[model samples]
Target: MALKILSGCINCDMCEPECPNQAISMGEKIYEINPDLCTECVGFYDKPTCISVCPIDVIITDPAHIESKESLLEKFKHLVNTDRI
Candidate 1:
């Protein structure tokens, strides 16, 4: 599933570097994740790095936008703009 930043975000800016897809960005008052670019770190890491480092547990799975692992992999491939993934 693609992730979303909840209101719990502390805006620490830590998650930005952790996202391989460059999906996370600074919003008006908090960090936001671009669902179109997020692959939940499927093709790049063993786990979602943003979730691993977010101190406030702000990043979370978007249940409304859930996708399978295979789909996530496809997303990762697209985000990286490569077929090698």
Candidate 2:
């Protein structure tokens, strides 16, 4: 599944760069995560970096965009030229 930035976001700009897929961006008043680009760092890292650095724990899973692990791994490979999954 993809991720979403909840209302609790502090806009501290900590989670932006941590996202390998470049899914997070500044919105009108807060940061937003692009579900199309978010792969939960499945292929890039062991865990989601945005969630790791978010001080307010604003990053949360998008239950609506439920995707299987295989799909996420494929999406990650399409984003970055990585051989591992």
| Count of backbone clashes, every candidate in sequence | 0, 0
Q: Report the alpha-carbon TM-score of model 2 versus the true structure.
A: 0.89
Candidate 1 lDDT over residue span 20-80, tens digit each: 8888999888888888888999998989999999887877899878999999998877766
TM-score of each: 0.89, 0.89
Q: Candidate 2 — worst ten consecutive residues by lDDT sum?
A: 76-85
Residue 25's C-alpha lDDT in candidate 1?
A: 95
| Candidate 2 residue spans exceeding 4 A from truth | 81-85
Candidate-wise lDDT, in order: 0.88, 0.88
Clashing pairs in 2: none
Model 2 has a clash total of 0
